[model samples]
Target chain A: MTVQTPGLIATPKPRHAPALRLRRLQEISLGYLLLAPALIILIVFEILPIFYGVGISMCDWKTGAALGVEGWQRWIAPCVSFIGIDSYTRAFTDPAMWHSLLVTATYSLISVPVQLGLGLLLAYLLFQKVRGQQAFRVLFFMPYITSTVASAAIWAFLYNPDKGLINSILTRFGVPEIRWLSDTTGIFQVLLKPAGVDLPSGLEGPSIAMLALIIYTTWVFVGYDITIFLAGLGNIPAELYDAAKVDGASGWTLFRHITFPLLSPTTFFLLMLTVIGTFKAFNHIWVMTQGGPGDATTTASIYIFKQLFQLNRYGYSAALSFILFFIILILTVFQNRFAGRRVVYD
Target chain B: MNRDKLKSQLTNLGIHAILISGALFMVFPFAWMILGSLQTFHETTLGTFLPEQPMWSNYYDAIVAMNGAKPCVFDPAAPLDILTREKGCMIVRYFFNTMVMGLGTVLGVLTTGTLAGYAFARMNFPGRETLFKLLLATMMIPGELTLIPNYVFMVWFPTPESWIATALNLPNAEPHNWIDTYYALIIPWIATVFSIFLFRQFFRGIPNELFDAALLDGATHSRFLISVVLPLSKPVLITSALLTFLGSWNALMWPMLVTNSPEMRPIQVGLRSLITEAGTQTQLLLAGATVTIIPIIILYLFLQRWFVEGISNVGIRG
Candidate 1:
């Protein structure tokens, strides 16, 4: 009976059972007829393409011509001898592929936590019954809905080392200009260099350029998280808080026992979304860095894009994307298994 | 009691201080965008935070600078080596193309989504639950997996002219495809799972009494959907339309892949080209960025209520 589960209708049983049976037959056909256009498009574009992508990943595909067949045969078979997971095997050894995956993991690892923490804090602050709360909420949520390309362009201007505002302010305090977008040095290395500490390459962490992207990404998405968190905070029963307060529970205690547990489902939902979102994120990173300054910011999506568009390595790119797809699928299922159980339904 | 009130007041003030600063950080880039767009390139290079005089002409120059863009030209022999011809200010054209794409996609999504949603919510059918579950499962698939294959399909699929030629058994037709066409941009995006899901959820909320009354009046399902259901579902219709259009307007990667033509390019692509081409001309680039985002900002302003409510529903309900 709950509204959360959609697509259930309770139809009262009608008299004249034969007529009702005839009506049921009509309903079945009509239902399918209604669904035809959407189903056709999903099958053609969404479903079939996954299989097509898998096929492309296994072949020595460069361009359509490299598929090396004419007429409808091109559709059925690429006509070249099947490469049989060669591209996938090649990717396993490819350092660039590994680097991109590492970069993607670092991005997700950093931005997701920052966004969740900052979003929850802000949501709790706003939930304190402050005046002008709605206005603040709207302001915070603006960036989430803005076009990433445009917003990233704006951030690029903000991050411009020479004439950018950040550098200008830093220079006023006699701090030197840092290349926010173009710097390839890891942030840890940058922070530690003055102390004569040099971390090894593997331990350097995400590059300064990647850090800038992560910051911008966090800025863009935290609003969504905050808004969702605010909605979650709103859903907890007020009586629970009242009872806890009457039992002499302090603010932190009340939040710990009542609010946080109740908000766990929303937290879990956002975690899943943010994980998937960070992996698939492209527009802003592409605009700001284009996987540049020596591929420091090249997440897996950007890596696949470079292979497909710039290098035209169709088979390899397809293979790389399939690997990414499996990673996301596994991460999602893993989270569902491990994290979903703790969610408070109420 | 007085001390407790004072402590709570201090805490409230501290919270406000934090929230206001956070809000300022969120809005700072947008403020910088507007300021940069109005300044001269020389001033931007010199790190002048504010313009001496707001150069409204930067917008004009940004528009005019778009004239240098080359339309993506593809001949059958060299599909990969896209060529270009110099054109006029593509801002207007890009806007028009984006509008067409947005409107077309919205219409298609709403039609397909509403019909399917209605059927799923209100009617019983064979394989109903299974099909619906399958639709939901597709939502989990990362779009990157589909990108290459979809691009391949768009390029390799036969043209309608070729289809006609083959049917008529005529001499071989030119090798034409969906690349750089409206068909490539609009059609593939129309059948999104999210739209179907959104509509289905909303449709399920409508009371069954309406349906029963309509049935007693001998109204067909289609007639009932059109007359009784749609009229009452205004808010959902608007929500879906807004979302679909916004998504289409904001699309970048897909449009960039399927379209390379200057005329076919949307505002986002045009703005991206500006960034690359005007690498040093920060003022003009910002101006172009400002222009591209204005429509969405305007839309957001008027429909802010629906935007928040719809997004909130997505979080809580989904």
Candidate 2:
């Protein structure tokens, strides 16, 4: 939501209104007092840390600084010195950072489209005057509300290569086994290798681990997306469909003209959400593989988290995070300028 | 006409097939996790969806692995045989700590959120509109990066005892580490902007006549908040509480960062360590994960309408 300010000027005093200024002053002070608790927390926890993080990013901080000289033992605190843009340059040049960025981009590029298509299809199906659709909607949405870590763990068990349900089912069907989460090789590369052909590195599809996570994410979120799309579909007028039907419009033509255009706002909203979601995706990835099998699924969120927590590279991680923030800002601004104009808001 | 009827019947059958199978895909994991929790460690493998004999002991073992001494003969630190090595998990403590954190966070958020929301919604004050906009604008700053700074702040922050002692002019007033305390877990997430926004939006729907009447009776803003506004705002308050409680309970990375002690860790973080410790033991892992999510799942099932309304109504903003 954008910032919305309604300027309501204080009313001028009426001639017969006795001592109204005191009441007005009380109102102003009381409002500020009421707002103080939330404001103080946000400023200390959110606002201050944002500036503090920026300051940290400008410095040479690798680990904790020695804060004492009591014999051989020393108390350590976070270390920093002004190094200015070095961490940013390093983050850009780091191969690990680039790979993680590529992974995130590739993931969003593939998963968001697939999620949209599947979500739309489900919404359309559920939108029809079908029996038991209400029950079906609840059943489908159960996964989205469940904890991501818990769901991912279940998927992990199901993806176990030796005794997993998926592999067992595949073997029963006479299909060879697939290492679902453990396999790091790109799916296209693996498929093409058996045929004695090669897909170029950058052109290769996501790794099997990435695909598994994608499947998990789709299963979790597609229902939520469908809910949104159904909400959008609910807004359309039935008379338009009736009139189109009377005019010999049918099937794809009906959707192509009326439904699709009317659903543009919802579609655009879901697109931005899905893109941003995939970029900051962490919980599912962390649970399923911990971005595992040689960093196959270590997207930007995971990478920056490791820098901040695992390696204790605060300054470097801060720099990496800002890049991510910058990218999201640009994407949001670009979407607002282009897609926002096209969305048919009622 | 006969041919068309048959085609329509077939189409209906096709639709049922697709929908049922899709739903089966959606539901099977949960059913499996429940079943897996019932199975013993050896029976958790594939091709064995059902246990040979329903192993009720898995839950016991799971509880023991949670580091609680429930239904057990000895302490975890007590000398034990090889079979008793699994009794050392601190799960009950994790649950206690998590509940404490969750309730604490909800109280903090609701208190702050409702107060600010009511003030912004009902109060006419100078710069109220401008300040609210500024609050919303603060949301533009991405939060994931602030973890380190927050962690450092927690580490360096003066302990409550130290502050109290300093204020009271006590002789011994050394700063104690607050890293693993409940304050560190609850305070950082005590107030969220989204909750405040949700509360504000809900409060705005209220008519001004009620407040004006209250004002005529010399009711202050906080008085109206306590007596009139809050009583009428059950739905918003419930939604806000549930969201905050669930969010805090399910939080992983932050709790993981702050609380390294098993005594202080929350259920999710505890579940993580359980997974790591359980290794290939799917029974224990699934059982622990199942325990971790059961509370929220039960809450969702009972308050299905409230939860669904919360999600969908919030979606109205987007």
Candidate 3:
């Protein structure tokens, strides 16, 4: 080089050559190709269907009819002529819809708290280093895995007033038989009769049939909550309990200070899930009650379903669905804003 | 001090007793279903916990009935009439249909989800992040929102509208009604956002170094994915597959909606029909339930460790 062979010409370094852009492009293309099947299906089946639903909600679409011409002109145009929030107005004014909402809210209110409470109690007991812990866990979890229809069928039989095991057992103990599924008598009224307390007529509460459903629902889901709590318990460091014991904290104090705060995240998660789950409950009602005994068990979901399928009011059903969606969204957002802040992530 | 300790021990024992009783309350229904399944028709109605004699024949009868077997009657006068009748239990056919649908859904989910997940995890590409975020956002939209539109689509997709029938010189297309077909059950479930999201999270946790090293050795991307990534992701794969299978196997609504004929019904819907038909046939219903549940229970038993681990993993990630 010093001898001026190339007049300060630099030698090319092979390692320093830019990686092939074509190779990177090929790699990315291959990745796209690999992902395309799922992406395409999701877009077609799920995402497109959602947008289509919104569009269908705008127009009065009927099943088993032509779209955009005859069917639209007949059913949809007239509806739209009357429809600037008219469907929503009808939904609000309709007492059946309001009753359904009330039923759903009350069901959620009663069922969610009871499930969480019982589940926590069970989980806490199971968490103790006891013999046959695994067996206990399996037994608790068994119901969660069973098919909803099967469980409902079993519960339906159990609640039979005539020859049901429950009524038979009650009779043996000199207690009055209950009309479990058929009775429209509010549980409060039934309780008052036995307790010699007169509840106000309006404050009779959820019907006995609805109460049976609530109990069944709570029973089925307690295992799921227990599983969650058990996981949370497992995550809590043993050292914290050791430290608390050393400082003379025990029982309620340790639970309140150490356990509750640490478990808050799990609790929040469960609550959010439970709320969403309760609102969207369909299978149980569909299988067991079919929103029956004068629509006492009919939640918003069943109402929406009936509107669409049975009544052929697709637009109205869609409107109800969107309204329900907003309710869920608002509640979830509110929970996230308030409760989520309290959830300490360790 | 010793007396106080004894008192505490006694209290603990009492607590355990209460907890054990509560556990019994939780588990009794399933136990009852099992026992009920073993009992005769008479015992089932009586609600007896223990049968005087377990009728193992009930299971055989159920199976024979499920298989559409007719009782061979010794009636020569109406021999042909009896011979042609299909009297086997329709439950067996429904069970088969459910299994096919469940397996189909599991396969579709696994294949589609795994590939998509691997791409999301390993590849750097344009719009990848945006697309994933969109997928996650779609999950927020409840399934109820799309129910009507989907039903409409199922009804109307292949068939031409009345207006279209008049416009074209071609004759109006026959209604290739997709309802009750395997397509209706299989197509809608093929794309599951939850499965995709789950698989993506699991795949992302996999190390990139192995893939890179494989690539450096001149292996292609597909080659590396198949040889390297697939081997490492067995647990997650099993978890996803099992979850997908269970969800499909237990599904009641979508199948119920689409399939109108009892012949096309899955085991869940069939069981529902059975419940309605013979509301007092507790033993038969329990027998049906036992058949429905045994497969899942066996699956869970074998894969208990994986299920617990996978569920916990999902809880953390999801």
Best-fitting candidate, scored by DockQ: 1
**Model 1 C-alpha lDDT per residue in residues B1-318, reported as the tens digit of each score:** 999999999998999999999999999999899999999878989878789999998887887677574333346675433323342346767887899999999999999999998988888888988999888767767676788678778987777877688777788656678888888889898988888888888888888878877876788898999999999888778888888998998898899988877889888888878877888999998998888887787898789777766666667766
Give the Å error, residue A320, model 2.
1.0
lDDT minimum window of 10 residues, candidate 3 chain A? A1-10
Q: lDDT winner among the candidates?
A: 1
Q: A111-230, model 2: which lDDT tens digit per residue? A: 899999988877777777679988888878778777766887888888888877888888989878899988887889987887898888776788989999898888888878877787
lDDT of 2 by residue, B132-239 (tens): 877765555555687777877788787788878987889977666668889899988878888888888888878877867777687777788899999998888888
- Those runs of model 1 whose alpha carbons end farther than 4 Å from true positions after fitting are A1-17, A62-77, B69-89, B156-176, B207-224
lDDT of 3 by residue, B235-276 (tens): 888888887787887888788877887667788887767666
lDDT, residue B207, candidate 2: 82
* Candidate 1 structure quality by residue, lDDT tens digits, A23-122: 7788889999999999989999999988888888887754465645664344345536578899999999999999999989999999999999999999
TM-score of 2: 0.87
Interface RMSD of each: 3.7, 4.0, 5.0
Q: Give Cα distance to truth, residue B186, candidate 1, Å.
A: 0.8
Query: Which 10 residues in a row give candidate 2 chain B its minimum summed lDDT?
Result: B79-88
DockQ (C-alpha based) per candidate is 0.45, 0.41, 0.39
Q: Count of backbone clashes for each model?
A: 0, 5, 3
Question: Clashing residue pairs in candidate 3, if any?
Answer: B65-B89, B68-B88, B69-B88
TM-score of each: 0.89, 0.87, 0.84
Q: How close is each model in CA RMSD to the real structure? A: 5.8, 5.4, 6.7
